[model samples]
Target: MAQLGIIGHKGRMGQALQQAIADAGHAIAGGVDAGDDAAQLADNCDVLIDFSAPAALEGNLHAAVGAGVPLVIGTTGLTQAHHTAIDNAARVVPILQTGNTSLGVTLLAHLVREAATRLGPDWDIEIVEMHHRMKVDAPSGTAILLGEAAAEGRGIELAAHRESGRDGHTGAREKGAIGFAALRGGTVAGDHSVIFAGNEERITLSHLAENRMIFANGAVKAAAWLIGKQPGRYTMAQVLGL
Candidate 1:
């Protein structure tokens, strides 16, 4: 069995991952929280899984590279600079980064892409997502992931054609734009729905997360798949062979 290490051992996801690691029959090399020595933990593990805050990403990446171990990053709310860092680190070690690690979400993304391609530009795409009240980021990363899939299928750039946080006095919806809406309340793990509206018809795709274990299990599976690989970036789709 592979020995795994966790970068964020105090959070909800981290706790779930601990159980998942055991369920998968993998050994826990160690775990590190905010002030812990991440480099030391990385050096002792066969693979590193990070569900930590975005602010701690650089140090985690450095630790993974320094130890020559593969890493799986499931942390959300990352910016462009963080992505650039991941890309740089990926050149030296195998790295898998994703907004949501659930296998169901990965399949959902594939279906969204297919539907968007067949529907064409006549259909307006809108994504809605809801999460637990404690979630800090708006629009949820999974919503953005679905939006990116739709944009890819339609051969458009999500950055240029994205819309969100619409309040009063918002003009008409732009053609070929992907819109997003976020809801936060109660203890919802996650809920995502993508609506494609067209003349006299509409199509919707959705996925609901009941708890944190789905993500944890998927992350463990992805981490296992990441071991013994050449230096490169990877994805949940690759793990599922989608």
Candidate 2:
């Protein structure tokens, strides 16, 4: 059994990860909250799982690399600079960064990619996501993951085709555009839907999260899977054998 260290140890996902580790027949070496020293925890554990805010990713990455530990990053709302930093760090330590860490969501992304490939640009693509009010990010990271899947199936870059939100006076829908909408309220764990609309028919794919444990369990499984890998960036699809 590997020893897992949790960043953001007192948060909801961190607590869930604790249970997941035990369920997976592993042990928690210890945990570090916002002001704690991640390097110390990394030195003690075989791997690290981070579910903290975007602001904490850099420090966590440094800590993991300094102690030569694999890391699983579940934090969302990361920017391009953060991605570049991750890319750099992955060269020194195995790292897996993903939006939603649910096995179902990984499979859903596969299906969405396939469907988008068969369908032509005549079909309009729209992604809708809803999360709990406490979630700080808009459009949800899962929404972006699904969008990337669809774009990849279409053989196009997501950055060029993404349409995040439309305001007043926005004209008709742009052909070949991928649109996104986000809703937040109540205590919903998470909900995501991707719609493909054609002239007369429409196709929709979705996944609903009933609780936080789905993500926690997936993260734990990924952490275990990453233990012996080479230093590099990894995806949940890789962990799930997709």
Candidate 3:
């Protein structure tokens, strides 16, 4: 069994991951909580699983690399600078990153892209997502991933077509625009829906997360898969063989 070290041990997701790993017959070598030093835990574990915030990701990743451990990162809200750092780190160790780790969500993203390709520009794409109140990011990383898939299907860049949060005096929905909406509420696990609106009918592709363990399970699976992988960056799509 793999010995895992968890970053962000005090947080909800971190605790959930700890329990999930133990339930899966894996061992927690150590962990770092809100105010603890994650590097110390990394030094003692076989692999590191991170579900920390954007602010903590760099340090956590650096610790894993310094400790010579593969990493599975489930943290979201990372900036472009963070992406660059992750790419650089992958040169030294295997790394897997995903916005949403539920297998169903990953499949939904794939199917959404396929639908976008088949439906063409005539159908307008809109993504609506909701998460728990404590989540800090707006227009979640998962939303961006789904949007990227739609943009890829249409042979366009996501930055050129993203329309987040409509304000007063907004004009008509531009052709090929991918709209995004976010909602935060009490104790909601997660929800995402991709809406395709056409002249005749509308189709909605959606996924609901009932438990956080789905993500924890995916992270564990990713860590296991990364055990002997070549130094590179990977994603849930690669993990699920999509």
**Candidate 2's error at 83, in angstroms?**
0.5
Model 2 spans with C-alpha error above 4 angstroms: none
Give the Å error, residue 79, model 2: 0.4
Tens digits of lDDT, candidate 2, 130-168:
999998888899999999999999999999999987889
Backbone clash count for every predicted candidate, in the order shown: 0, 0, 0
In candidate 1, which residue pairs get closer than 3 Å at backbone N, Cα or C atoms, i.e. clash? none
Question: Which ranges in model 3 have alpha carbons more than 4 Å from their true place?
Answer: none
Q: lDDT, candidate 1, residue 237?
A: 93
State every prediction's TM-score relative to the real structure.
0.99, 0.98, 0.96
Residue range with the least summed lDDT across 10 consecutive positions in model 2: 164-173
- Please report the TM-score between candidate 3 and the true structure: 0.96
lDDT (10s digit) by residue, model 1, range 1-242: 99999999889999999999999999999999997779999999999999999999999999999999999999999999999999999999999999999999999999999999999999999999999899999878899999999999999999999999999999999999999999999999999999999999989999999998999999999999999999999989999998
Those runs of model 1 whose alpha carbons end farther than 4 Å from true positions after fitting are none
For candidate 3, which ten residues in a row score worst on lDDT? 30-39
